[model samples]
Target: MATYAIGDLQGCLSPLVQLLEQIQYHPEHDTLWFAGDLINRGTESLETLRFIKSLGDRVKIVLGNHDLHLLAVSHGFGKLKRGDTLAEILTARDRDELMDWLRKQPLYHYDESLNTVMTHAGIPPCWDLHKTQTLANEVENILQSDRVDDFFATMYGNTPDKWSDELTGLDRLRTITNYLTRMRFCDENSRLDLESKEGVNTAIKGYAPWFNYPTKVPHDCHIVFGHWAALEGKTQQARIHALDTGCVWGGSLTALRLEDKQRFSTPCTLNRKKT
Candidate 1:
C-alpha cells in the first residue's frame, strides 16, 4: 500500500481529486496523510469534508487552525467571518456527524516506522516528540468528552502566549491549541510570537522559524506541516516539509509520496478560471 502526505485542501476538492488520480491513489490500498486545513476558503467545504470523512481509516488527518475554527463555530464558540466559506458545512444535513468526527481527530500524529511526525503547524521548539504527544493527549481528552463545548468556548485567543507548566484553565487550553495549530515564529527565548507568519529571513528581530531555534529536535525524524501558505511550500531545512502551496490562492495542490518522498502536484482549478 502506498502512503501520501498532502498539503492543505482548504475545501478545494477538484484539485484534490485530480491529485489523487495523478498519484493513482486507491482508497482500498493507499493511505493519505492530510497536513490539515481540509476545509475553508474554497467553494465546496461540505463536499470536501464528506469526501475525506468517507475515506475513514484509509486517511489520517491532524487538526488544522481552520479545522478547529470550524468546530468552534459549530459549537457556537466562535462567529462566522466575512469571507468564510464554511457555510456549506455549517448548514449541511450531516453537520452534526461531520463536526463530531472532526472534533475527535487528533492534533498531532507520529509514525515511528516512518520516522515522521505530522501536525498542521510545526511543533514548538520546546516540545520533544514525547511531550508533544502527551500534550496532544491532554487536548484530545477534552475534545473527546461530552462537554467539550467548555473547551471550545475558550479555545480562541492569543493570550498566555508563553508555554508553562503552571498555566491552567482555559488559558492553558487555548495556549496549547495555538502552539499546535497556529504557531509560526518564536523569539530567541522560544516564547511563541504568535503574530508573525513571515519567512525566516524576513521575520522580525528575535523571531525565528519554530524549527530553526537553537534547541535540538531529533535529527533522524521528518516533520511535515502546512499553514503559513506564504512559506509557499518551503522550509529550507532538511527533513522539514512545508506543504501549504496556496492552492486556494491559485497555486497547485501538492502530495508527497511517503515511501520515496516523491512529489506530485496538480494545478488548482481555482487558477483555471482565466483559462
Candidate 2:
C-alpha cells in the first residue's frame, strides 16, 4: 500500500479526483495525506469537503489559513473576501458537520513510520518536533473546547510576530497558529515576515523563507508543507517538500508518494480566476 501527500485542494475536487486516478489509488490499501486548504476559492467547496470527509481513515488533513477563515466566517467572526467561493460550503446541508470536522483537525501531523511531519505552512525554526507537537495541541484543545468561540474572537491578528515562551492566552495561540498556517518568510531571529508573499528571492531585507532561518534546535524529520504556491513545489532541499502548485490559481495539482518520493500532477482545468 502506498501513501500520497497531496497539495492544497482549495475546493478543486475535479483535479484531486484526476490526480488520484493517475496514481491509481486504492482506498482500502492506500492512504492519502492532504496539505490542507481543502475548501475555498475553487468552484466545488461543498463537494470537496464532503468527499474528503467521506474518506475517513484513508486520509489525514491539517488545517490551513483559508480553512480557519471558513470556520471563522461560519460563526460570524470573519467577512467573506471578494473572490471567496466558499458560499456553497457555508450553505450546504451538512455545513455544521463539515465545519465541526474541520475545526477538530490538527494543525500538525507527524508520522513516525514515514519519519515525516506535515503542516499547512512551515514550522518555525525555533520549534523542535516535540515542541511543535505540544504547541499544536495547545491550540487544538482550545479549538475543540468550550472556549473555542473565545479563541476565534481573537484569532485574526498578526501581533507578537515572534515566538516566545512567555506569551500567554490569545497572543500565544495566535503566534503558533500563524507560524503553522500563514508563515512563509522570517528573519534570522525567527521573526515572521507575514507581508512578503513573493518567491524566495523577493524576501525583504534581513528575512528569508522560514525553512531557511537558523534554528537553535534542529529537527531531523522531513517536512511536507503546502501554503506557498508561489514556490510551485520547489524548495531545493531534499527533505523539505513544497506541495502546493497553485491549482486554485490555474496551476497544476500535485502529489508526492511517500515511499519513493515520486511526484504526480494533474493540470488544473478550472477557469483562471484570481482570489
Candidate 3:
C-alpha cells in the first residue's frame, strides 16, 4: 500500500485527476493526504469537493486558509473577494453536507508510523509536536461545535501575532488557526509575519521562514505543508515538504509518495489569473 501526499488543489480537479492517473492511484490499496485548499480559485469547486468527499476513508485532509475562508463566507462572515470561484460550492444542493464535512476536518494530521505531521501551513517554530496537536484540537473542537459561527466571525485577523499559553477564547483559536493555515514567515520571537507571502529569499528583515527560525523547537517528525505555492515544492530540508506547485496558476500539480519520496506531477491545463 502506498500513501501519497498531494498539494493544494484550489478547485483544479483536472490536474488532480491527471496526477492520480500518473501515479496510478488505487483507492483500495493507496491512501491520499491532501494539504488542503481543496476548493476555490479555479472553476470546479463543487466537483472538487464532491470528488474528495467521495474518497471517504482513503484520504486525510487539513483545512487551509482558503477552506476556512469558504466556511466563513458561507455564513456571511467573510466577503467574497474578486477571483474567488467558490460560488458553485455555496450554491450546491449538498452545500450543507459538504461544508459540515470540511469544517469537521482536522487542522493537523500526525502519522506515528511515518513520524510525519501534515498541516495546511508550516507548524509554528515555538511548538513541539505535542503542543501542535493539542492546540490544533482546541480549534477543531470549536469548528465542529455550535460556536463555529463565532469562530468564523472572528477568524480573520493578524493580531496576537505571537502565541502564549495565557491566550484565551477566540484569540487563542484564531492564533492557532493562522499558524496552522496561513503562516509563512515569523520573527525571531516566533511572532508571525502574516503579510509576507513570497518565497524564503525575499523574507523581510528579522523575519524568516517558520522552519528557518533559530529558536524553533526540535521535532523528530517530518513536516508536510502546501499553502505557499511560491516555494514550488522546495524547502531545502529533506524532512520538510512544500508541495504546492501553483497548479491553479498554470504550474504543475504535485504529489509526493510518502513511502519512497518519489514525486509525480502533471502540468496544469487551466490557466487561472493570478490573485
Per-residue alpha-carbon lDDT of candidate 3 for residues 1-275, written as tens digits (9 for 90 to 100): 99999999999998999999999999999999999999889878789999999999999999999999999999889999999998888988999999889988999998888778899998887888889999999999998899999999999999999999999999999999999999999987789989989888988889989887643435566889999999988988878999999999889999989887889999998877456
Q: Report the CA-based lDDT of candidate 2 relative to the real structure.
A: 0.90
Candidate 2 per-residue C-alpha lDDT over 43-120 given as tens digits, one digit per residue, 9 for 90 to 100: 888889999999999999999999999998998898899989888888888899998999889999999899888999
Give residue 236's lDDT in candidate 1 (0 to 100).
80
Every candidate's lDDT? 0.87, 0.90, 0.90
The sequence of per-residue lDDT tens digits that candidate 1 reaches over residues 16-60 is 999999999998999999998999888778889999999999999
lDDT of the structure predicted as candidate 3: 0.90
For every candidate in turn, the CA RMSD to the true structure comes to: 2.2, 1.3, 1.4
TM-scores, one per candidate: 0.95, 0.97, 0.97
**What would the TM-score be for candidate 1 when compared with the true structure?**
0.95
Candidate 1 CA-lDDT value: 0.87
